[model samples]
Structures are given as structure tokens and as C-alpha cells.
Target chain A: MTGPISGPDELSKREQKALESLLFRLADDEFVLAERYTEWQIYAPTLESDLALANIAQDEFGHARLWYDLLGELGYTEPDLIWERPPEQWQHSTLVELSFPDGGWADTIVRGYLYDTAEQLRLEALADSSYLPLADRIEKVLLEERYHRQHAGNWLERLASGEGHDRVVAAVERLFPHAMSLFAPGPHEDNITEFGFRSESLQELRRAWLDTVIPTLDSLSVPAPEPAEVVRPDATGRDGSHTDDWFELYDAFTHTYTELENPTPVRLRGEGA
Target chain B: MIWEVFRQEKKGDYHKHCGNVHAPDREMALMFAEIQHARRMHANSLWVVPQAEIAEVDAEEASFGGTTDKAFRWAMTYNDIDASFAQEVADSEKEQEKAAKTREAQI
Candidate 1:
């Protein structure tokens, strides 16, 4: 009642598929990207960075859970929905699924920088979505992501000015191609836009991201990557094609959950048995 | 070091336990507490106490007769509060007033 009561009456056939695609993109992107970020949990250059990354990972996983819960309400079982998906069936952007190659602090910083900027645009648009549930979810997600954006911005400033400037610049150049691919078109993007689920097209969001990120990189004296001639992929993630990194991520994240044969007993906080 | 933060939601309200924050000093603790607890615009003000400065008591050590009886201290003890309860309270007040008067006279 506080905001607009502009949500759909009930999801139509096209609307349902659009919403499902949106949720899959958002949920899979965050879940998979958070898995990659967790690899830096103990290896970050600074303790504060480690804690910040861990917090970001937690928020991403939390966002994924909220999306998964929404999916469950739509009548999909959670485990089957998440674990049953093949790598090629995931809808996460290629940017999120890219590997950082263990290139040390610079790679992590650059990855966080690019992903946070892109995610901010995507999430801000989703925050205004006509879907009430998705809008509400974005409200909570944006709060945490604001911190992630700030963390990335702060590091971008520091690394771009400090002795590690060249290293960060190099990493940016290497990753920007895949980062731009986050906007690769999916089959349902036009329907999603037409339904008012998102206000902007993928190109528009990418432009907005560049507008926001380029100036900051400029201020930090970090050179931005040149825009590629051909940004589309014949077989890219937005169209459900993923790299081997997706399998790596799926394996890492689902390790513990897959190990149990039967339902595990819940353990109380201080209980030994 | 860890600092325990207590937040007052409005003016003149008692500070309630919000959460703990880790910081090296009072300044950092204040910064973290402001962001962690107060960023949502709910907190009016906050008090941060170093974790080490807090004194804690366990309820188990302070139990009275395993909770068998402490009815005299509770309002429910006077379940039948028609006339006798008022009379009893009046008598107690009178006794206290008399005792105070006697002490004053001695003084």
C-alpha cells in the first residue's frame, strides 16, 4: 500500500516465463559468483578485505536464497531447481562466471570492481520492477550491495593510485571483455523489458554501467579497456551456454550438500552429539 | 577487540542491546556501530562499551529456592485485593511514615 500496487494480476504465460528467466539469471549469477568470491576468503591482501569479501559473499548467497524461495513459491522444489541444472542451462552472465586465474590481489579487486558496478545497475533497475516480490527482494539486496559497491570503489581508488596501479590496470584489460559479456542477450530479454520487469535494455544497462565506472577509473588514473568490435557471442552464458568455470563453481558450492545420503541431524550450537 | 553496542531508538529511551562489533578502538568501534546498527535510520544514538569492561551475572547462581516461592515480591501475591489488600498497604505506609517520623524526632 505504501508504494505502487503495480504488480501483475497473475503471471501470464509470457510473464511467468519472463519472471522465471529473470529469477534464474539473478539467482544463478549471485550463487555462482559468490562461490568464486569465497575462494578469496582467507587469501585476501588485507584482513578487512577478507571480511568485506566474506560479507559480500554472504549477502549474495542470501539474495540467492530469497530468489530460490520465490522460485519455490512458484512450485519448483529448491534442491531440484538448483542442483539439477546443468552448467549449460544456467542463465548467469558470463562476467560473473569468469575465473580470476589466481592472479593475486589485483585480479580480485578488478573482479569486484567490474561486477559490483554492473550488478548495481541491474539491481537498481530490478528495485523498481513491477513484480512486487522481485521489487521487495531488490530493496533488501540493494542495501547490502551498496556496501559491496563502496568496497569495490574504495579498492579501485587505492589500487589504481598505489604501487599496484599497473597490475590492476592489466587485470581490468584482461577481464573487461568477459565483463561486457554480462550484457549478452537472452531469448526473453525483450519480453522482460516489455513486461516492465526492467526499464532498460541490456545495451542501455551496459552504457549506464560504463558511464558510472569510467569516470571513477579515470580519477584513479586506471586506463579503461577499449570497447570490443563484436560484443556478442555465438554461444554465451546469457543464452544458457556457460564455460567450464560454471562446473568448477557448482562442484565447489554443492560439495557438502551432495555428500549426505540421508537427512542430516540438526546440531544445536553447543551440543557435541 | 570487540565492542558491545547498545542503541537508543529515540530520545530518552533506554539503550537496548543491538549487537557486537569488532574494532581496534573506540573511534573505529563508533564508526562500525554507526554503519552496522544505525545505517537503517532506526537508531537515534548508540553507546559502545568495550567487551572487557562488561560485568556479567549468570541467572543460575542467583536463583532463589529453585523458583519454589518468591510470591511476596510479585504483584500477583495479592490475588484477593478487594478490601484487605488496601488495608494492608495502608498499614504498611502508616508504619513506614511512623518510623520516619520517629527517626526524624530522634534526629
Candidate 2:
């Protein structure tokens, strides 16, 4: 049997572009979501919840780092890929970039549950990818994602039964539209699947995401939005288009790097326990 | 019978001594440990050992590390050399520094 696609050289020109686009999508979504998750650091309702979210954010950043390192293999430096890149060039779903409303713990739970369900499906599809490098990284990410989903799911169920049930419903109503953007395909969607980068189609993933999230949410009395009312056609975050919040978020995150004019971002290099 | 309990707070974390539990057998020991040692605190895994099975040596019985001034074994011995160039060395230095402080506290 032939070995998996280990390096850039093994891919055809189209396959390489497809792989690059896929990596950018994965890395950008994870990095942006993690950046937003950090905003809850000291603000979460409880100490244990705060630590849990922070740990999840760190896991997402680590996953993003793995994807970005692969991009490095394809010739982009870290700065070129992130710190120095224009805000408009990022390819993440707009759902991840939105800010959490103050005291809106419900917002965080709903958003996390929706986003993580989608992420789980996406990772599963990539688990058997023809691109060996991408496939190899999925298991590590998937292991951590298990906790994230359970965390979100548990919080969602508990919060739905409490005095904050109204807030949770409002969060569902407000965030469902943007959550759809997770399934919004980038231009290379077909190329990615055609080249064996992801074995499942985006539509299939979207369908699976719906099947998993909608019923549980419905059971919790959280209504999923009608498809027509929440159609966010402009949220093709996969194609580099994003909401105004993304650029603002991007600038804030890169502010330190730009201010210091540092030669490179500090990498703890797995040394920090 | 008393069971000595070791609790690990999270995956990849060290299994540290917490508290002990009293149970009749291994299964009961584990169940008791789960409630007494792990219920309130976050725990990834737990280990239990019978108090009878554990062996201990007190300071009066033996001098730990031979009470030697063997400063050569510590990374801080060569204070002039920079450990920054290598991560493993830096990590070792930090660990040794922590150990030194603990030993100082004990004394």
C-alpha cells in the first residue's frame, strides 16, 4: 500500500491549493474562536467554569498551531500566516468572531455547543484524509474536542432549566443565524473533497451538524431558527469575507505583536506545563 | 482497613497523595476513594493502595541524599553558564531550584 501524503511534494498543484485552503479554514476558525474564548477568562460565572473554558481555549490554540505549522510546511512563515496577514485574508466562519455579550453566559454556551458540534463533524471527516499530515493531527484535536462538546452540552442543559432559561432562549434566537455560517463553503470546497483532503462533503457535514445539534436543542426547548430567516449569504467566511467584528478582533489580538515590533512570536514550545 | 489514596487532578498531571479512606476491599476502596477524594475536587484518575502495603523511611532512620553538600548534582552549580540556549537544561535548572526551596523549607 502507498504511504499517505506526507509532504507538499507529493501533492499536485490543485491538491496543494486545496490543502492550503483547508488548512487556512481550520486554523483560522480555531484561532479566532480561541481568541474570543479567552475573553471569558476571569468573567465566567464560576472559578471551575473559568478554568474549563480557558483550558478549552488553550486546546483550540494548540490545534490552530498544528494547522499553522503544516502551512509552514507549504512555505508560509508564522508571521506571514497570522501576525502580518491582512484581516480580510482570514478564512474563518463569522460565528467564531462575534463578541460575547456582557453577562451573557447563555450566549457562550449556545455558541460553543453549535460551533463545537460542527467542529467535531469536520474533524471526523478529516480523520481518514488522503493528506497524511492533516489526518495525523485530527486525533489529538478530536480527543480534546470531546470535553469541549460535553462541557457545552452540560452547561446548555443545566442553564436551560434555571432562572436564566429566558436568556438562553434569547441567545439561541440571536446566534443561530451566524452559527449557520459554519457550513458556508469556501471556494475550494469541491477541490478539497475531490483531492481526498476531506472525505465528506460540506453539505453532508452540515446535515450531520443539524441532526446532532437541532434535536438536543429542541429537546431543551431551544428552537432552531428557520433556514430562510437566518440565511447569511454574505457570511462566506470561508472565502475571506467576514463581519466588521472580525477585523476589530484581529487588530486587538495583533496589537501586542505590532506594538513590540518583535522579530517573532514567542513559542512556549511545550515547555510550559 | 485503611487505604492510602493518590489523586490526579487532570490528565497528564502527577498522581499526588491526597487523603486516605477506610474500606473493606479493593472495589470498596476505589468507590470510597472516588467519593471521599474525588467528588468535590476535579479528578482525572485515582489510585488506591492499602496502608499496610506502603513502606516509609523517616529522617531519623536514614539521612536522605546522604546529607552531602553535593552541589554538583544541581543545575545551579554552574551559575555562570547560561541555560537559556537549551530548553531541557532550563527546565532542569528550574526544577532543581524548586527542589532546593522545598528542601530549605523542610530544614
* Residues B1-107 of candidate 2: C-alpha lDDT, one tens digit per residue: 88899999989999999887766567656755765666446899999999999999999998876776876778875779865689988799999999999999999
The ten-residue window of minimal lDDT in model 1 chain B covers B63-72
Candidate 2: tens digits of C-alpha lDDT, residues A1-273? 234687888988888888899999999999999999999989887655676677788888999999999999899988999999999899998888988888888998888998999999999999999899889989988988887787787778778878878999999887888888888777788888887889899889988988887798789887777666775756668878888888889989999999999557767874332
How many Å off is the CA of A106 in candidate 1? Answer: 2.1
TM of chain B, each = 0.62, 0.62
Give the candidate number with the greatest TM-score. 2
Off by over 4 Å in 1: A1-9, A230-235, A262-273, B1-107
Clashing pairs in 1: none
Chain A TM value for model 2: 0.95
Model 1 reaches an interface RMSD of: 4.4
Q: Give per-model TM-scores.
A: 0.69, 0.73
Q: Classify candidate 1 by CAPRI docking class.
A: incorrect
lDDT of 1 by residue, A1-273 (tens): 023324445777788788788888888878888888888877876554566677778778888888877777678875666765556788887767767676567877788888888888998888777778888878778878887777676666667778889988888776777777778777888888888888778899989988987787788787776565534444467778777777787776666667764244353332354
Off by over 4 Å in 2: A1-3, A270-273, B1-107
List DockQ for all candidates. Answer: 0.06, 0.02
